[model samples]
Each structure stands twice: as C-alpha cells, then as structure tokens.
Target chain A: MILAIDVGGTKLAAGLVTPDGHVLETRVAATPQDADAERLWKALEELIAPMPEAEGVGVGCGGPMIWPDGRVSPLNIPGWRDFPLRERLAASFPGRTVRVHNDAVCLAAAEHWLGAGRGHANMLGMVVSTGVGGGLVLGGRLVNGGTGNAGHIGHVVVEPGGPLCGCGGRGCLEAVARGPALVAWAQEQGWSPGHGPLDGGPYEEGRAVTGRGLASDALRGDPVARAAMARAGRALGLAIASATHLCDLDVVTVGGGLSQAGAPLFGPLEEALRAHARMDFARRLRVVPAALGQSAGLVGAAALILAGDRYWDAI
Target chain B: MILAIDVGGTKLAAGLVTPDGHVLETRVAATPQDADAERLWKALEELIAPMPEAEGVGVGCGGPMIWPDGRVSPLNIPGWRDFPLRERLAASFPGRTVRVHNDAVCLAAAEHWLGAGRGHANMLGMVVSTGVGGGLVLGGRLVNGGTGNAGHIGHVVVEPGGPLCGCGGRGCLEAVARGPALVAWAQEQGWSPGHGPLDGGPYEEGRAVTGRGLASDALRGDPVARAAMARAGRALGLAIASATHLCDLDVVTVGGGLSQAGAPLFGPLEEALRAHARMDFARRLRVVPAALGQSAGLVGAAALILAGDRYWDAI
Candidate 1:
C-alpha cells in the first residue's frame, strides 16, 4: 500500500491506497495557511500516524515546485516559500520511500490508470476549480517539462487583449473562465448575487456560482445566464482546442466543481473547439469529465510512489 | 557518407555529407510540382545519380505525414498529395536505409546534433521561410507524436484576434508572421520597396519580397518596412515566449530564409519575448539563430533514421 497526500490551498487529504487501486482508508483536514513549515509537518504527521502500514508516501502540491530539491513555493500558500516538503515527509514517515509531483500531473496519472483516460495514449487531465490547472499524459507517459511544469494549460492565452491573469499575463484561459472570474464577470455585468434590482436570485461566489445558477436559468429561459455560460464555454473550447492541436492529445478529461455544470460547459465547448481546430485529427479529439473526483489527487500521488522508479526513469 | 534531401514547394536540394559532418557534394533542382509519384521518384533518383556512394538517404518534407506509411501530403506542392515517398526511396535505393521527417523537425534534430542546440537538453527549432514551422527536441529526443505531426507550432494561436490563417483558424502565429503575410502587410501599407522614397527607384517584384530586402530597408532606415519587420519579429517572439512557458525549451534555434534577416529580426524578437513572458522562469528562455544553415534538414533526417530503434523504444 502507498500513503498519498494531496496538499491544496484550502484542504489536505491523506489516503492509504492498495496496489490494485483501492483506497483502504482516507483522512481530510483543513490546511492552516498561516502555519510555518514545522506546523505543516506536524499536521501531515498526524494524518500519516493513524494510517495503517504502507510501503511509501507520495505528495502532490501546487505550482512552482523544485523536484530536484523536493521544495515547494506555491503562490496560493504564502508560507511554503522554498519549503522542504520531501525532507519533512521523510522525517514524518521514516524508513518509507517518498516521491512528489504536481497535483495536476498526479491527477493525470490517476486518470490514465483508472479513470476516464484509462488506455488512452495521449491525454490532458484538467481541474477547473479555484484556479485552472492540468497535467498531460502523452504516449502513455506523464509530461513534466524541464521544471516539472509542463501542463500549465490554464496560463494558455485565451484572449491576448482580455483581462489580466494572476500570473500577470493578459487574457489567460484561467483569468477569463475560472470560477472566481466567472462570478466577477457576472457582477461586472450588473447581475446581482442577492443584492439589488439586477438580482435574479442568490448566486454563489465562484464560477460554480454562475454554473449552478446559470444552468438552471438557461434551462428556464434566462438569456443573460445562457450568454454568460456560452461565453465561458467558448473560451474553454478555444483553449482546449489549442492544447489539442499543440499536444496532439487523444482525450482531455476535465474535473472540479465548475465542470459539474456538465452540458452547459461541454456542449458549447465542443462547438467552439470545432470552430477553432485546424485538421480532422484535431477536431476528432475527445473532451470528457474526469472519472476520478476529490480523491484523484490522492490516487495520483500514490501512483507516483507505486510507479516511482519507472516514473523517474521517464523525462 | 549520408545522402540528405530537402524537398520544398519550389526547390529540391540533395547533398552527400560525410560522417564527419562535411558536405562533400550537393545537387540543387527545381521541384516538379505537377509530377506523379513515378515522376517524383525519377526526380529524386536523378538528383542522387551524381552523388558519391551513400550509406543512407534522409528526406525532409512538409508535414502531416504518416511515417509508418512512408507517405506525405505537402500543402505547398499540390501533386504531392499522399505521395508514397518512403516506398519509392526504398525501392530505388534498395538495401540502403532511408528515413523521412518533416523539414522543421529535421532542422531541430540537426541543431541538437551539431549546431546551436548542441549542448541543450530541450530545444525548439523553428523555420521562418515561405511558411513558419517548428520542431521539438524534448528530453534529448525528437518528439514525433503518434502521427508524426507533433511540432506543428506554426499553427499555434498567437494573436487570438488577428488574421485568418490558411488552416482556417483566426490569428495563428503562421497566418500573421509568415513570409507572404509580411509582404502582404507591407504592400497593404503602400510601403514600396527601395533604398529611399525616390532614390532607390520603383518597387520590384520577387527580389524585393525576400528577407534580404527587409534587412536592407531596415538598414536604410525605411520606417514602413522597419515597422513591418518589427511586427513580424514581435509576433514570432510572443509565440516563442508562450512556447517557452509551455515546453521549457533551453534554446530556440531559428533557421529558414527569413531568419537570415539577422539582428534586425533578433533584436526586436528578444525585446518582445522578454516583455510578454511575465514570469521569471518563462523569461529565462533563450532564442538564437540556427547554426547549421540549410544542411540542418539533411543532418536531422539522418539522425531520425539512425535513432529509429531508440526512438521507437522510448515512447
């Protein structure tokens, strides 16, 4: 069995997974964003301590990580600047093998092994949650570029002249179609979220806010919500289409709360992709929902440890 | 000795290169665009007839090729639609090895083996000629995606809202910065070719349309020509920056006729890349002119054939 841990901005998940892809046990805890490295270590140890015997441990983290040093410096988590995560995990679970990779990359591994992308040779697995992130599995191998940051499809330019992205680029796919941006865009258009004359109803505060509210509204004949969703879908399709063209992925699996909007997103996304892609090969690429859910990161991390030698052997 | 052949829309170049990297002999011929498969075979045979004994033959042609099938359909050459190049080469040069690859991909291999990318682990080789094209060397291996169409970076979206590309996409990097597009842009702006407003005389046709003309005009301080060249440079740079972010290339070795424009293109190209790539990691990427000149295609194609077994084993 492998102990898998997923470290996100909001939460931490620890799972004990078996060789045949079974999650024997799992735990979840809210992450203490302000905590120092030591505090985070203690939190992780607590979760690992209670788990049954495992052969190894694996970690999946956010962006800007150093694989050689096993250190991380995620923008969302302020305290982890140059944090030595591998050493901490080693200390916490002595005598156990440990490996680390990006969360999206891990998710892609999981999908390739057991989810929607099973048996697919070239695939891109994406999570469109708080911020967009993804992993690429090409020719049945995970694509971690020089810095282990290959699949930053979120940063792919959607609108070169559009809104400013958090990475300081203009009109990234993340900036225009991510959850928070969707809410902000709705608010900018005077669609009140339980606030004023423009208030259609109580809308959530993320892109999911628009997705959940808009899907029903569109179904019930609300033009504004339908238009908003259509815009998001088109932008998503454009970005996905570009990625498909560039990477030659056979399939793209999308996950996250925002993707739960289902056909509201996938329908127009497909249409927009068809409009943008160049050849028949690119146009035939498939876009599907991620089969693995909240536990995908955990499963992927565990896979990293289980397939450690081979994983490292690949570029 | 290795025989290298580079086939383009208008020209066919064949060379007898020694194992030590010297071109001992060469043959240049105008392409037979209207030829059938048999005639095309005859042309290749005619070119190779004058060359010294060769160990292998390497071919570089336009893409969307099926390598395993040994066939190609070049867009620029109408008669080459699904041409069985590999079969013909194998039949004609029986017992001698023959391998074919996309021209830009071959150029990338050339640079990696003996040119600007000699010491790099990750490199992107680009060709800016009548059309823009690209080749990738990632993790020290040329990436020929499932269909041998991996590095079609020219089709990558650069200006999301710019021009209509021949590929049916709007604002592809190729559509905006390709040679014909640059000339078209200059003509649309009424920028007549010459050393000055009236001194250098009336605009000529084919000669003035070359990269050399652009360089001469830029040297002569022609504002409109300089602007057009700068625009092309900036577009190319932006695309390279985005590619750097995506693939983490150590160097970008540029070849092709337009790259011969030299510093006039490189200066503005570097400036635009640095300005657009907002991140530190993304900004550290380097862009340099290809060192292998025109022979890169032959060398790269030879490398592909030589590394065939190893390449197949990797993926």
Candidate 2:
C-alpha cells in the first residue's frame, strides 16, 4: 500500500492506494493560511493521519521546490519556504520511504500510467487552472531535467512582450490562458459576475471570479465572457503549438477546473494550434481533455513511490 | 573503429574515428544538386570508400525524415525524396551496425560526449546558422520524441504574428533569426552588400548574403548590420528562453558560423534571455559557445555508435 498526499494552495488531500493505481481511501481538508510552518505541517498531519498502513509515502505540491533536498517553497504556501517536507514525512513514516515531486509531474505520471496519456509513449500532461502547470514524457521516459524541473510548460514565453505574468515574465501561457488571467481579461472588458463594475465587494483571494463562472456565462452567450475564453484558448494554442514544434509530442492532455470549459476551450485552442503548427509531424500533434480530473495529482503522487522508475524515469 | 558520415544540403563529409572520439581519417565532397538518388548514393560511396575498417557506422543528415524506415527527404536535397539511406548503407557493409539520426541530434551527441556539454546532464545544443537546428539531452538522455524530432527549436513560434517562415509558419525563430533572416532584416533597413537589391547577378541560394558577411559589417560599425544582429539575437534569445523554460536545461550551446560573431550576437542574446526567463532556476540557465565547430556533426555521428547508449540514450 502507498500513502499519497496532494498539497495545494486552497486544499490538502491524502489517499491510500494500491500498487496498481487504485485509490482505496481519501481524506481532504482546507489548507491553512500563512501562519507558520507548524500550522501547515499540522494541516498535513491531519490529512495523512487516517491513511491506512502503507509501506511508502508519496507527496506532490506546487513548485519552486527542490527534489533532492525535498525542501519546498511553493509560491502560494508562504509557510512552506524551504520546509523540509521529505525529511519530516520520512521521519513520521518511520521505516517507510517517502518521495516528493512537483504536482504537475505527478499528474503526468498518473496520466501516463492510467489516464488519457496511457497508450502514448511521448506525452505532455497539463493543468490549466489558477496557473498553468505541466510535465513531459519522452521516449517512454519521464523527462526530469538537471534539477528535476524539466516540464514548466506554463512559463513558456509565447508573446515575448505582451501581458506580464505572475511569475515576473511577459506573455507566459499561464498569464494569458489560466483562470485568473481569463477572469482578469473578462473584467477588463467591462464584464462582472456581480451587479456592475462599480459594485462594492471585498477582494476574496482565489474566489473573486472563477473559470467555471466565466465558462457558464460564455455558454450562456455572454459576449464578454466568450471573448475572454476565446482569447485564452488562442494564447494556449499558440503556446502548445510552439511546444509541439519543439517536442514532437504525440498528444497533449489538459485537466484542472479551467478545462471544464470543454468545447468553448478546446475549439479555439485547436484552431490556433492549426494556425501556428507548421511541419507535417508537428501538425499531427493533438490536444485532448485529461481523464482522471482532480484525483490525478493524488494518484500520481502514489505513483512516485509505487510505480517506481516506470514513472520516475529520471531524478 | 567507427565510420561517421555527416550529410548536409551543401556538403557531405565522412570520417573514421577511434572509440575515444578521435578522428583518424576524413573525406569531403559537395552535395550533388537535382540528381537522382543513385547519383547521391554514388557520392556517398566515394566519400566512405577510404573509411578504415569499422565495426559500426553512424550517419547524420537533415530531417523531415522517418526514423524507423530511415527514409530521408531533406528540403534542400530535392532529388532524394524518401531515399532509403540506411538500407543501402547496411547492404554496403553486411554484418555491421549502421545508425541514422538528424544532424542536429548528432551534434548534441558529439557535444555531450566530448565538447561543450560534457559535464551537464540536461543540455540543449543549437546551431544558429543558415537554418536553425537543435537537439536535447535531459537527465543524461538524448530526447527523440514520436518521430525522432524532439528538438526542432528553430521552428518554435516566438513571435506569433511576425514574419513568414520557409515552413509556412509565421514568426518562427528561423524566419526572424537565421543567417538569411538577419541579412533580409539588414536589407530592409537600407543596408546593401555590393550594389542595389535589384542588381543581384543571380539568386545564389544559400550565398545570397551570409551571417559572416553581416557580422563583418557589424564589427565595422555599420548601424544597420548591428541592429540586424541585435534583432536576431533577441529573437533567438526569446526562442531559447522558451526552450529553457520548458526543458529545464542546465545549459545551451550555440554553434554554426553566426556564433563566430561573438559578443555582437551573444551580448543581445544573454540580455534577452535575462529579460524573458522568469523562474529562479530558469534564470540560472547559461548560454555558451559550442566547443567543436565544423567537425561537431561528424564526431557526434560517430558517437551514435561508439558511445552506445551514453550518447543515444533516448532514441
């Protein structure tokens, strides 16, 4: 048995899974605010306390983290700055082994093992949510770069001089296509979920507007909302086209809340991809929806310990 | 002993090398024009005739080719469309191994084995010349995606709506930063090599205006030439920034004739890279000059067989 933990800014989740990719039981809780490392650690402990007797543990979280040292400084989790996650997890688990990887990589491992990327040898698994994240598998091997961060696809500079990204870059795929970016664009175009643009409301972080809300509005034929989703898809398509041209991908599978936009998201995406992709092989690349949905990260974290080198082809 | 052959549109070269990457013998000849496949095969036969007894042969050529069948259809070599290069080469030397790969991949293999990429595990090798070419090594493994064309960095669409490329894509790095692209940009800015644009004696193909010629003018303090090179560097830097962000590369090595422009090219490139790279680790990426110049391809081809899985880890 394997204990898998999925750490996110908004939520924390844990799962007990079998070796063959089955999730037996799962636990979830809201992540704590920036209080202290102890508070975050306590939250994780609570999430993992009920995990069944497992021989190994696997954890996946937002990055700007180190793999070897197992120290994490996720952008959203301020309390986790250089937190020795692996050491603590390993110590808590006693004799069992503990492993950690970027949440996006875990998603790729899950997809490659049992999700939409199952049959493909070279694939890119992406999460287009609050921010875009990705992982790659090439030649049937997980592509971990020198420092285990080989698949930061969201950060690929598509427009070079356009919108400033949250990560301090210009025109990143995430900046143009992720949920926050879409909501920002929609609001800039004089659209709002509330009564009007001047409506008074507190800036509730991570919930001021959601991709699902915008997507529903777009489905309802709201022009402003439709335009934002269309523009987001276009930006995503151009970025994916560049990646396909360079990586010769077999397929690209996208997940996360933003992906719930479905046809409204994928249609314009495929169109932009067709416009930018050049060569015959590159044009053959496909973009599709991910199968596992939210459970992907948890299952993939389990894979890091259970699937072994089959998913973790490189350090 | 290893028999290495480097095939380019303009030239074909062969070499006999030891197991330690030492070239013992070499032969060179200009590539034949619009001739039959047999004519091209004959030229290859002559080039390899004197390659001392070897156990294995490695051939590197331009791509848009099939890896499994070893069929080649390089854009410049119009007559040898889908030529059966591996079959013929195998038949010529029975009971011996012959491997074929893209020339850019070969350059990467050679560099990883004995040149600039020696110590780095995850590296990207780029040839910024007449047309851009690239190869990737991640986690100490050569990357060959679906069709063995994973590292086509030159074609990445950095500027989505900028210029038309030879491959029908707009704003491709090759379209905005290659030798011809730089020359074209300089010409557009009212700089001439010999006489007026209409006074050209003939369309000399790859020799219309070379990167070396532009570099000389730039070094001679011509503002137009300087701006062209600067623009080319910025384009290349943006493309490489995208690549570095995605691949999580440790280093990138630039080769080809244009690389000889030195500071004039590298200065702008480094600046642009610093401008676009956002993540802390991505910002740490370093761009350096390729160590082995012209012979890099031949050496890398030999490495395909000689270095075994060390150089050909992925494909």
Candidate 3:
C-alpha cells in the first residue's frame, strides 16, 4: 500500500492506496483559510491520523514548489510561503519513500495511470479551475523540469494585449479563460451570478453566481453565460493550438472545476481548437475531458512511488 | 567513427565523425529542386559514397518524416514525396545501425550533445531558413513526439488572423517570421534589396532581393530593412515565449542563415520574448545563438546512437 496526501487551498486529504491502484481508506479535513503555519500542520496531521502504515508516501500540493527538496509557496493559502511541506511530512513518517509533486502534475499522473490519458506516448493534462494549471507526460514519461515546473500553461499568452493577469502579464490564457475570468466577463455582459435570466430555467432562489452556477446557467440556455464559456474556450483553444504545435502532442486531457462545465465548455473548446489547429501534425490533436475527478490528486500522488521506475528521473 | 548525413532544401552533405565528436571527412552536393525520386536517390548515393568504415550512420533531413522507420517529404526537396529514405539508406548500409531524424531535431540533439544546448536539461533548437523548424530536448532526452514532429514551432500560430501559411493555416509563425514573408513585408514598405538606400550605405549593383540580401541590407542601417527583421523578431519572440511557457525550457538556441543577421535579428527577439514572458519560471529562459552552425545536423544525427541510452526511444 502507499500513502497519498493531497493538499489544496481549501482541503487536506489523505488516503491509503493499494498496489493495484485502489483507495482502501481515506481521511479528510477542511483547510482553514489563511490559517497560520502551525494550524496548517495540525490540519494535515489530523487528515493523515487515520492512515495505516504504507511502504511509500506521495504528497501533491499546489506550486511554486522547489523540486526534489519540495518547498512550496502556493497562492491562496497565504499563510504558507516557501513552506517545506515535504521535509515535515518525511519527518512525520520515518523510513518510507516520500515524493512531492505539483497537484496538477499529480492529477496528470493519475489520469495517465487510470483515466483518459492512458496509452498516449505524449500528453498534456490540464486543470482549469480557480486557476489554470497543467502537466506533461512526454515520451510516455512524466516530465519534471529542473524546477519541477515543467507545465504552467495558464501563463502562456493567447491574446497579446487583452488584459492584465494576476501573474503581472497581459493576455495570459489564464487571465482570459479561467473560471473567475469567465464569470467576470459574463458580468460585464449583464450576467449576475444570483440574478439568473429573466425567464430563467429552474432557477433556485438567491443562487450565488459561482463558477459552477455560471456553468449551470449556460446549460439553462443563457446566451451571455454561453458566450462567456465560449470566449474561455477560444482563448484556451488558441493556447492549446500553440502547445500542440510546440509539443507535437497527440492528446490533451482537461479537468478541474471549469472542466465540470462539460459540453458547454468542451464544445466551444473543440470548435476553436479545430479552427486554429490547421497543420497536418497539429491537426490530429485530441482534446478530451478528464475521467478521474477530485481524487486524481491523491491517486496520482500515490503513483509517484507505486508506479516504480516510471519517473525515469535517473534517465 | 559514425556516418552522418544532412539533407536540406538547398544542399545534401555527409560526414564521418570520430567518437570524440570530430568530423573526420565530409562531402557536399546540391539538392536539385523538384527533381524526381531517382535523381534524389542518386544524389544521396553519391554523397555517401566515400564514407570511411563506421559502426553506425545518422541521417538528418528536413521533415514531415515518419519516426523509427524514416520516410521524408521535405518541403524544399519536392522531388520525392513520402520517400522511404531510411529504408533505402538501411538497404545500402546492410545490417548496420542507420537512423534518420528531422534535421532540426538533429540540430537540437547536436546542440544537446555538443553545442549551445549542452549541459541544459531541457532546450529548444530552431532553424529559421527558407522555412522554420524546431526540436526539443526535455529532461535531457530528445523528444520525437512519436511521429518525429514534436517541435514544429514554425507552423504554430502567433497571429491568429494575420496571413496564410503554406500549411493551410492562418497566421502561422512561419507566415509572419520566415525569410520569404519578411522580404514580402519589406517590399510593401518600398525597401528594395539591390536598390539599397536613397543615398546607399555602399550600393552594389545586380544584387537580387533574396532573404540573404534582405539581412545584408538590415546590417547596413536601412530603416525599412531593420523593421522587417524586427517584425520577424517580434513574431519569433511571441512564438518563443509560447514555446518556453509550454515547455518550461531552460535555453533556446537558434541557428539558420537568419541567425547570422546578428544583433539586429536577436535584439528585437529578446525584447519581444521578455515582454511576453512575465512569469518567473519563463523569465529565466535564456535565448542564445546556436553554436556549430551548419554542421549541427550531421553531428546531431550521429548522436542518435552515439549518445547511448539518451534517446529513450524504446521507452
């Protein structure tokens, strides 16, 4: 069995996964927002308290994380910057193989192992959620760039001067296509999250306009809502086209909250991708929804050790 | 010693290199434009005739080539379409290890092995001649993207609605940044290659307005000429920014005749890249001129086998 720890801005979860890739036991806790370092550590300890002994452990967390040594300064979780989560975790569980990876990379690894990206030699796995993030599986091996930041597609430029990004850049794909950006654009077009449509389809009273709510609104035939998603798809498609061209990738699997937007998100994404990808090499790109959902982080983290020589790190 | 061959639109060159990466002997031949298959075969045959006894051979040609079993239909050498260059070369060599790679990939491999990209774990190598081409080395392994076309950055769209690309796409980087396109744009601005300046910087008669002529003019302080190159640089920088972002590259080494245009070509390229690359991971990308110049192809092709387990093709 392997121990899998998943750290996110809002949650801390731990699971005991089997050799055949099954999560036999799991523990969860809400990550207190803006909590101090000690609180975060205590929450993690509580999350993993129920996990049984295992041969190896994998921790998947948001980046800017240092590679190998595993230090992280995740956005949103403001309490932790340059946090040595790996060192602390390793110290907690002595004599067990421990590995840390970017949460999106873990998601990609999980998808590659047991979901949509399986059997592809070279793939790009993306998570378009509160933020856009990605990971690469090249030549059938997960790539770890020197900084372990091999995939950061969110910051790639699609529109040269469109808008200012949180990353301090203009026209970043994330700035144009992420969940918040979509909602913001929809609002500009008279879309209010809780307001719904004038002749709304099955509106729940006082529903907040969250990313999920925006997706449901599009499904209920809101033109402005649909347009917002389409705009996101267009920007994402352009960036994917650029990526497919550069990486010669055969497939791209997308997950995360925006992915839950389903066909409303994918339909326009595919259309725009088809429109932009015209070359023979890039024409064959396959964009698909990720199969594994939230559990991907934990599973992929487990695979870091359970998958054995797959890292190809030594090579 | 290893046998190395470089096939290009304009030239076919072959060499025998020592184990220490030295070219012991070489041969050159002009690749006749639009020649028939027989003529192309004969040229290759003649080029490889005088090679010394070698354990293996590596051929690097401009692509649209198949991997593992190499078949190439180079854009410039239209004499053969889908020609089995690998099969034919292997047949002649008789049981020796004969490998074929895209010339640009070979350049990347060469740069990774013995040139500007040396010591960098992940690198991008580019060739910006009649057409643009590129290759990648991720985590120190030459990436073939299964079809031997992973790094076709030339066809990646930088300007979504700008112009038509030969690959049936709109606003491909190649359409904006290639020699032909640069020359076309320069002419629209009333810059004539042979005409030089109104009070010419050192006027010479009978110079045709080829891509090389345009670069020469730019070197002589022609505003229109310099603008054309800078425009190309801007497009290139945007494309490189996208590539660097997607690949999380360490260094980008550029070769090709245009690179010889010197700082005028690079000055703007760097500026544009920096302007687009805003993220810390991307900001660290180092762009440099390619070393080994014209011979990178031959030497890199030889590296396919010479580099030992580095190819990771079987995995």
Candidate 4:
C-alpha cells in the first residue's frame, strides 16, 4: 500500500492506495488559510496519521515548487512560501520512499494512467479551475522537463493583448480561461448570480457569483453567461491548438470545475480548436473531459510510487 | 562514418560524416521543380552516386511524411506524394540501416548534438525560412510524438484572426513569421524590391522582394521593412513564450535564412519574449540565434545515426 497525500489551496486529502491504484481509505480537511509552514505541515501530518502503515509515500502539492527536492510556494497558499515540503515529509516518514510533484502534474498522471488519456502515448492532461494548468505525457511517459514543470499550459499566451495574467503576463490562457476569470468576465457583462433559473429560489439568496453559477446560468440560456463560457473556451482552444502543434499531441483531457459546464464550454472549445489546429497531424488530436473527477489528484499522487516507471523519474 | 542526406524544397544534399559529426565530403543538387517521383529519385541517386560507402544512411527530408516508414509527401514538393523513401533507400543499400526524419527535426537534433543547444536538456530548435518549423528536445532526448511529428511549431497559432495560412488556418506563426509570409506582408505595406541601398546596383535589377531584402532594408533604415521584421519578431516571441511555458524549455535556438536578419529580428524578439515569458521559471529561458549555418540540416541528419541514442529511436 502507498500513502498518498494531496495538498491544495482549499483542502488537504490523504489516502491509502493499493498498488493497482484503488483507494482503500481516505481522509480530508479544509486547509487553514492562515497557517504558517509548521501549522500546515502539522495539518498534513494529522490528516495522514490515522492511515494504516504503507510501503511508501507520495504527495501532490500545488506549484510553483522546486522539483525532486519539493520546496513549494503555491500562489494561493500565501502562508507556505518556499516551504520545505518534501524534506519535512521525508523526515516524518523515514525509511519509506517519498515523492512529491505539482498537483496539476498529478492530475495529468491520473488521467493518463487510468482515465481519459489511458492508452494514449502522447497526451496532455489539463485542469481548468481557479487556475488552468497541465501535465504532459509523451512517448508513453511523463515529460519531466528541465525543472519538472513540463506541462504548464496555463501560462501559454492565447490572447496577444487581451488581459493581464496573475503571472504578470498579458493575455495568458489562465488569465482568460480560469474559472474565476470566467465568472469575473460574466459579471463584467452584467450577469448577476441569482438571476438564473437555478439560483432564483430563496435557498440561493445572497449566493456569491461563481464559475459554477455562470455555468448553470449558461445552461439555462443566459446570454452573458454563455458568452463568458465561450470566451474561456476559445482561449482554451487557442492554447490547445498551440500545444497540439508544438507537441504533436494525440489526446487532450481537460478536468476541474469549469469542465463540468459541458456544452456551453466544450461547444466553443471544439469550434475554436478546429479553426486553429489546422495541421494534418494536429487535426488527428482528440479533446475530451477528464474521467477521474475529484479523486484524480490522490490517484496520481499514488501513481508516483505504484507506477514509478512511467510517472515518477525524479529521486 | 555515416551517409547523411538532406532533402529540401529547393535543393538536395548528401554528405559523408565522421562519427564525431564532421562532414568529410558533400554533394549538392538543385531539386527539379516538375519531376515525377521516379525522376526525383534518379536525381537523388545521381547526387549521392559519387559518395564513398558508409555503414548506415540517415536522411532529413521535408515533412508530412509517414515517419520511420518514411513515405514522403512534402507540401512544397508536388512531385512526390507518399513516396516510399525509406523503402527505396533500404532497397538501394541492402544490408545497411537507413533512417529518415523531418528536416526540421534534423536541425533540432543537430543543434542539440553540436550547436547552440548543446548542454541543454530541454530545448526548442527552430527554423524560420520559407516556412516556420521546429523540433523539441526534452529531458536530453528528442520528443517524437504519436506521429513522429513532434516539434513542428510552424502551425502554432500566434495571431488569432490575423492572416490566412496555407494550412487553411488563420493567424498561424507560419502565416505571420515565415519568410514568404513576412515578405508578402511587407510588400502589402508599400515596400518594393530593389529600393534598399544593398539592391540599388545593376546586378540587383529584377530581383524579387524577399525576406532577406526586407532585413537589409530594415538595417539600412527603412520604416516599413523594420516594422515587418518587428512583426515577425513579435510573433516569434509570442510563440516561444508559449512554448517555453508549455515545455519548461531552457534554450531556444532560431536558425534558417531569415535568422540572419540579426538585430532587426532579434531585438523585437527579445523584447516580446521578456514581455510575455513572465513566469519565474520561464524567465530563465534563453532564446538565441542557431549556431549552425546552412549545413545544419546535413549535420542533424548525420546525428540521427551518429548520436542515435539522443536523436533517433524509430525503427
């Protein structure tokens, strides 16, 4: 069995996974947003402490992190800048193998290993949530780049002069297509959260505007919401087209919250991808929703140890 | 020693190369513009007929070919569509090995093996000639995608809704930055051939407008020509930034005819790259002119056999 840990800005999760990738036991907790490095470490430790003994430990944490050594400083987790994550994990789980990688990369691993990207030798697995990120699997193995940040598609410039990205660039795919960014764009176009059919009832009063709200509104035929989804979708398509041409990809699996928007998002995405991905080889690519869902991060974290030959190369 | 062959739209070249990548002997011929497949083959046969025998043969040919099998149907070469190139070579050199790959991929392999991209584990080697194309080396090995067409960056969309490309796409990097495209754009902006100081003499009469002429004019202080180079440079930078973010690249080497434009192209390229490659890791990337000159394609073909461990993996 392997102890798999998934650390995100919103939550911390741990699981005991069998070698074949089944999760036998799991634990979860809301992440303390204001926690210091030690406190965050303690939260992770407590989350996994009750799990049965395992042969090794694998972790999927948010980036930007130093790979192989695994010092993390996720953008959303302000309290854990440059935290010595892998070192602490190693100290806590002495004598057991420990592997740490970016959560997006982990999500990609799960998709490639057992979900949408399965059987595809050249695939790009992506997530479009609070941020848009990805991991690449090429030649049937993970492409760990110069610094283990190989498939970071979020920063790919999709719009030349459209919007400023959080990474300090203008017109990044993430800036245009991330969940919150879509919701914000919708709101700018005069969309109100409670105006849609799904949010008109008393139970939904005072609900905050969110990407989920925008998706629901788009499904209910809200023009502004649909336009916002289309905008995000187009951005995603352009970036995917660029990636497809550059990598000669076969399959592209998209996951995370916004992907659940279904037709509203995917419709425009397919159209834009078809328009931009014009090369013969690029035309052969398939873009689909990721199959592993919410537990993908945990499964991918476990894959680091269980399927080390393909997913894990860093010591 | 290895026999290396380079097939391009305008020319065909073959060389005898030492194990360390030195070209010991070479032969070149202008490709027949309207020859049939058999005639083209005969021309190639005649070109290399005088070469000394070698243990194996490696070839770099213009693409859209069936890789490993080496059936070629290059876009510029209308004479050969799906020609059985590898099979013919194998038949001609019976007991010896023959390998074939895209010419752009060969240039990348050459750069990685012996030129500017040396010592870099993750690099993108590109050519901006009549067409814009590239090859990628990741984790110190060539990344051959599902169709063995990995690193064909010409089709990467850089300008959405900008210009129509030959591949039936709008706003492709090739459409914006390739030599002919840039020349066309410059001409449309009221620039004419033979107007620059370098082309004023009698010997330069009747010379067509070319990317080289535009670069020369830009260096000699022509506004339209400078703007054209800047446009191409910016497009290149945007594509490079996207590639760097997606692949976590360390070094980018730009080669081919237009690359000789020097500061007129590279100045804007660097500025745009710095503007868009804003990620902390991406900012670490270095974009430089390709070190190898016109012989890069031949050298890279040789590397397919001489450094097969890093460049050639297909059967």
Q: Per-residue CA lDDT of candidate 4, range B1-315, in tens?
A: 889999988899999999999998889999999999999999999998776488889999999999889999988789999999999988888898889999999999999999999999999999998899999999899989988999978888888998999889899999999878888888899987645445342225555566767777787778888898999999999999999999999999999767867898999999999999998889899988999876788899999888999998774
The TM-scores, one per candidate, come to 0.91, 0.94, 0.94, 0.96
Q: Where in model 3 is the C-alpha error above 4 Å?
A: A194-207, A311-315, B194-207, B311-315
lDDT for position B214 in model 1: 58
Chain B: TM-scores of all predictions: 0.90, 0.93, 0.92, 0.95
Ranking by lDDT: 4, 2, 3, 1
> Which residue pairs come into collision in candidate 1?
A179-A207
Runs with alpha carbons beyond 4 Å of true place in candidate 4:
A194-208, B194-208
Supply the global lDDT for candidate 3: 0.82
Best by DockQ: 4
Highest lDDT: give the candidate number. 4
Instruction: Report model 1's interface C-alpha RMSD after superposition on the true interface residues.
Output: 1.8
lDDT of each: 0.74, 0.84, 0.82, 0.89
Candidate 2 — what's its lDDT?
A: 0.84
Clashing pairs in 4: none
In candidate 3, position A286 carries an lDDT of 94
DockQ of each: 0.48, 0.76, 0.67, 0.84
Residue B299 C-alpha lDDT in model 4: 94
Better of 1 and 4 by lDDT: 4
lDDT of 4 by residue, A1-315 (tens): 999999999899999998888888889999988888888888888898887477899899999999988899987788898898888888888898889999999999999999999999999999998899999999889988889999989999888997999999999999999878988888888988745345342225554576766777787788898899899899999899999999989999999877867899999999999999888989999999999966899999999999999998774
* Residue-level lDDT tens digits of model 1 in A1-315: 889989888788999899867787989988887998778768867877887477888788876788745688877778788898988777767898778887878887888888998988778888886678888776677766666777777777777668888878777778877867876676667653332112343344542354445445544445565566677788888877777766666888988756766676778888888877876458668899999866889988988877664244343
Candidate 2 structure quality by residue, lDDT tens digits, A25-47 = 88889899865999999989878
The superposed Cα distance between candidate 4 and the true structure at residue A9, in angstroms, equals 1.2
